[model samples]
Structure formats: structure tokens, C-alpha cells
Target: MVIVKDERMSRKRTYLMCPPERFTVAYAINPWMDTSAPVDVELALKQWQLLRETLARLGHTVHVLPAQDGLPDMVYAANGAFTVDGTAFGARFRYPQRTAEAAAHRAFYEEQGTWAYVEPTEINEGEGDFAYLPDAYGGMILAGYGFRTEAVAHSHAQEALGRPAISLQLVDPRFYHLDVALAALDDGNIAYYPGAFSAGSQRILAQLFPDALLADEADALAFGLNLVSDGRNVVLNAEATGLAAKLTAAGYTPVLVELSELKKGGGSVKCCVAELRP
Candidate 1:
């Protein structure tokens, strides 16, 4: 007797590219700055440009999207939407102040027709609270359910993606998103700020990936541990001395990047951009 295997199950996933014009969008927030502190506008713009270049250097097609009139923090594009499988799922920001970002995201995806799409009903912000980790058993996407993405919304994302979802608890206000604390390495091992990950989340991570690296509290708060890797090479903040050495010993080469401007705005390199379609 001959047996038939399912061809659909064996197919590989496809990746999409966004041109430079649609990559980043910025909104000036001069008035929002604390007068007590100095505003490094020049430095901020330089770091922002560096973030764009970093994504491009990773071989992603960048698209610098247009910004809305009043949203100053909008330059950190990850807060806008989540895109996967050539489809864009717009977000409904939990904070009322950020609700306007949805409009920009909707407009961008609308122009790109013939793509699968999902419009969020429940409150579900994008990259700020979620990260997709690539692995051999398909891929896993983690959704933080406390600050911005609700538990119910995470369920919706799981259903939408047709893959398993790991729900993470973002108990700390400072770590409003998972990406703010966690980054997945090339080998499916995760590097995260120990203080930022909840006890429950840590248990889950340990169970799923026994080799996960727990970063130091000082380095984590300083955003020294956050990194991006091209599934082979990892780029990190230069100040992550301890973590960098550890990664090197682990057989991964770490490229250090300077991002002083992002620190001024409570953001590191990871928060400033999303590795879209990679």
C-alpha cells in the first residue's frame, strides 16, 4: 500500500520586504520634553536614522511611513502594528493617548491590497508588548498581557496566526512590553532582563527553553542586554560588557551599537524599531 503525505505541511514560510519609504515614521515631541532636562534633538534624530540603517543592513526592505500631526513618540514605529504572513494586523492601543496610531497603520495596509489582514477588536498594541521567535517547530510569538495587550487579545492573535502563543505577564509598568525586556537569540534561546520577567513567565521560559539566558538587573535597566540577531549574528549595545562576554563564550559574535539618543527617551535600540518580515 502507498501512503500520501500532505504537501501543504512541508512547505516553507515566505518573507516579505517593505521599501525604505515605508520603514519609519516620526512625530516631533518638543513640548513633551522635561524642561528640567536637556533635549538632545540632534542626537535623537541621529540614533533614529541609525535605527533605520540598522534594519536595512539586516537586508530588510525599509519603508519610511508618513507621520501624523500630533503624535510625538510615534517615531518608535513598533507601537503601530504587527505584520506577519504578508498581512498587517492593526492595533488598538490600551492607552487612550496612543489611539491615534491606529489610523496611520490602517492607512498604510489599506493601500497594499490582496493581502490577508486582521483588524483588532480588543486592545492589542503591537511590537511594544509582543515578539515573534523563530524556531524549528514552526515559530512562537509571545504576547504580553498586562500593560497593553490584554489576555483576550493574545488569544485572538494565537487564533489569527494559527500557531502556538506564549502569553507573558508584564507586571512592571517600566516593562510595558515584552520586547522591552526580552530578545530571542538565533538558536531559539532567549536573553532577557531577569527583573523584568515575572516568576511565572520565567518558569514557562525555562520549561520551553532550558538554555535561556537571564541578564543582570543593572544591565537590563540600562537597556544593555537587548539585542537583535540575524539568526546567526547578534548586535547589542556596547555597554553590555558582561552580557557581551557571555554571548561570546557561548559561541555567538556580538556587534555592539551606540544608541545614546534612544536612552534619553526611555528607549533602547530594540524599542526604537521592529525587525519586520525577518
Candidate 2:
């Protein structure tokens, strides 16, 4: 099968991440989370560190978000805020357990004083629902809603980012966030799992990215779509063999990272990473 990819350039990006110092599965929120399951905090931290060091080795700048106690899921920093063109749109989680994580994002943005942080009035899970495609249609936001983020928050994000937002409805609870089912490979292309989206949303995606790489259910269940790409290189879970093959066929170098430990908290590479587009 031929994969039609539209690309011209790729650039190194600056990323924001939190140390998995206090990371654990102390509660059950998402389907992946099982409070009864044993969490190897040491392994989790090691995995997170590997992810960070891997990004750094790829010539990307990684900024650290100090982990706070009592907030184990804070390590999933992508849910904190969606920063685009230097402006930060903060998140308000649906579950109360993750609510305090938003304030931590607010503090990071405010304290850094680099980004024009906008505290949200609506309940939006930041990058969890918002995926920006810079080269697609001159840049747009693919926003998701159903389980975690509010649909109304799409307009707020559109207004904040100065980009048109295409609302996609996620039907599967496991793929609660857009980042879980769909990942923007770069600015022009994407790879997604259709089963995670509504039939209508799936149609929309197919029409939007006719040449997109598609992931099978096995790959999606492996957290394949929870990836971070720097145009040329894509970092994802090592378990996503199908996705890795698909990505490689699409002309992207798949960089597999061991992030299974963090999966206990219901996130992977993209979850621990927040791109700072300044």
C-alpha cells in the first residue's frame, strides 16, 4: 500500500514535562486505571526519565514541570494545557481526582510568565482533547468531546488559538481523549484509530486526511496513538507494533519508548509531553 505524505520541513520543538516522582495508580478514573493493580513507582519514574532523555537526544528541549505530592496523574502533563503560538489554554478535568492538576498547569504557565495563559471557564482537558495540525489547511484544531472534554470548549479553544476547530466525537471510553485515538504525525498528516471515534467523526477524519495512516484495534489498545512526533521522528509506546509499521510506511521514523509503566495512570508518550509552541 502506498502512503501519500505531504511534507516540506521538520523542526525541533520545546516540550514541557513533569517528573513521575509522585506517579502511581492510586485511583481509578479512566478505563485503563485499576486502583487494585500494583504500581511500580520506581519503574514508572524510570520509564518517564527514559522518555525525557529520549526526547532530549532527539534534539528537543525538555522543560521540567515540578511534580507535586497528592497528584499522581500530574505526570500526564499534556492534560494540563494546550500551548500554541505561545498562548496557553489551561484544562479543567472532568474527574475531581484530576482537577487539582489544572491549578498546577496554571501555576507553571503563570510562574514561567512566558506564555499568555488563559484560565478556562469551561471544562476542557487541554491537549487531551485538542490536537493542532499546523500544515493542514493552514493550521486547525481537531477537538474531541464525549467522555472527558466539553464540546463547548472547542469554541473557546478556537478563539484562543486563532484556529478553526473541527469537533470530533469520541465514542469509546478507553479512547477518552483525542490524543488517545488520533495523533497528528506532523503538521500535514495523522494516524488514528477509527473504532475509537463516532461513525460521523470517522467519516470526517477520512475526508480530512484521505492519505492518513490507520491503526488497527490491537495498536490502539497498545496506546499507539498516544504519540509525540517532531515531524520526522515519532515517539510512541514500544508495544504498538502495528502502528510502528504503519508509521514507518508513512515515511516517519518510529522511535519506540518504554512507557508501559506509566500506562497504569492511563497515558503514554503524548500524555507526559506538552509541546510549547512559542
Candidate 3:
């Protein structure tokens, strides 16, 4: 396999994260969530801390968001907003359970004074459904719908970010969020689970990313595709051996992290990470 080199791989990244102080699986939204099961908050906190530390160790700046007491899913900061060039398109959650989160996130963005928050006219789940592709792909935004985010929100995001948007419809209930089924890596590469997307969406992805790496069912089940990349390195679930091997072969270093406790909340690495672009 020939490896493509991206010169902008060394670009520094800024990430926003909330502590898992109020994290828990009290309700079930996606298929991965099971409210009946108990969550280990201690382990969740430890895992989240390790993830934050990992980002810091990788030379990325990590910004902390104060965790509000009633918002259990606030730790999934990626759902807060889709930010680009310091402009934030606030998320409007589809489910009532998460609706309150939108306001809290908007408040945070406004208080930061760093981002110009834009109220979205439609329902969008922030970075959970909208991923920023590399410059190789013309710095396009990959938007997902069919679960949490609405397709119409793509145009709003495009307008806010001043970038083109490609809408991908998710088909599998388990992969409710696009971040769980796909990752936009550096070097114009993408890794995803095809089974999670609709037939038409899969066709679109195939045509657009002919050389995209495919994750097997086992890896997909482990949320292997839910990853964050800094061009040269990818941080993802530790149990996804198949995807790790594939990433390594593609000339990318894979940084495996454990988030089993956090998985009970239907999230992994990317879920807790919100990229701050400028």
C-alpha cells in the first residue's frame, strides 16, 4: 500500500472537553445505550482524564469546560457545536433529553469570547454529525443525518463555516451518530464502517473516497471508527485490533485508549473531543 504524505500533518490542534463529573447512562437514546445497566463513574472519569492527557501529550492544547450538575451527557462535548475558524454553529438536539444541552453549550461558547456562536435555524448535533475533512478534500464538511441531526442543517453549517458540506445518511440504529461510524483523517484518508450507512450514502462515500479504509463488523461494534486524528496519529478505542492494524499499515500511528465505562453512555474518544479550528 502506497502511503500518501500530508505536509500539514504537524498542525497543532485545540480541543474542548468536559470532565465526566456528571457522566452516566441514565437514559437510552441510541442502540448502544442501555439505561438498565449501571455505569462506573470513577472509571469513566479516569478514562476521560487519560484521553485528555493523551491529547496534551500529543502537543495539542486542551481546553476545559465546566461540567454542569444535571447534564449527564455534557461530557460528550463534541455534540456542543460545530466550530470552524472560531465560528460556532450551535447544536439543536433532536431528543428532548438532550434539548437542554443546547442552551448550556451555547452559553459556554458565548462565554468563551473566542468563538462567535451562531444559532442554527434547524436541528443539528454539532460535531457528532459534522466532521471537518482535511485540506486534501478541499476542507469540506462531512455532515451526517438520519438519527440525531437533520439533513437541512447541512446548509446552515456550510454557510456558517464557509465550506462545502457533503451529507451522508446513516442507516444503522447502532451507529446513530456519524462520529461513531466514520473518521476524517489527515492525508485525505477516511476510515469508516460501511454497514452503518444507507445504500445511497454508502454509494456516495464509495464514489467520493474510493480508497477509504473499511472497518470490519467487530471493529465497528467496538466503536473503532469513533476516532480523532491529528493527521499523523489516531486516537480510538483500544479493543479495535483490526482497525488498529489497518491504520498502522496505512502509515498512521494508532493511539489506543480505553473508554469501556464511557461506552455505556454511547460514546468513545471522539465523543468527548470537540475540535476548535482557527
The predicted structure with the larger lDDT, 1 or 2, is 2
* Minimal lDDT window, size 10, model 3: 1-10
lDDT of 3 at 223: 86
How do all the candidates rank in terms of lDDT, highest first? 2, 3, 1
- Candidate 2, number of clashes: 0
List candidate 1 segments past 4 Å from native.
Answer: 1-35
Which should have the higher lDDT, number 2 or number 3? Answer: 2
Candidate 3 error regions (>4 Å): 4-8
| lDDT for residue 18 in candidate 2, whole number 0-100 | 96
TM-score of 1: 0.81
Q: What lDDT does candidate 1 reach at residue 53?
A: 71
lDDT of 3 by residue, 1-278 (tens): 56654532655799999999998888888887898888889989999999999999999999898888888999999998998888999999988878888888888788888878899889999999988875646778889999899999999899888889999999888899999999987747788899989899999889988888888779989889889898888999998878999888887789999999888888899999999885
Indicate the residue-level lDDT of 239 in model 3.
Answer: 84
Cα error, candidate 2, residue 206 (Å): 1.1
Which parts of model 2 have CA positions greater than 4 angstroms off?
1-9
lDDT of 1 by residue, 131-214 (tens): 776572487787777766888887887787665678888776666677767886653567787567689987887788777667
Best candidate according to TM-score:
2
lDDT of 3: 0.88
Q: Which candidate's lDDT is highest?
A: 2
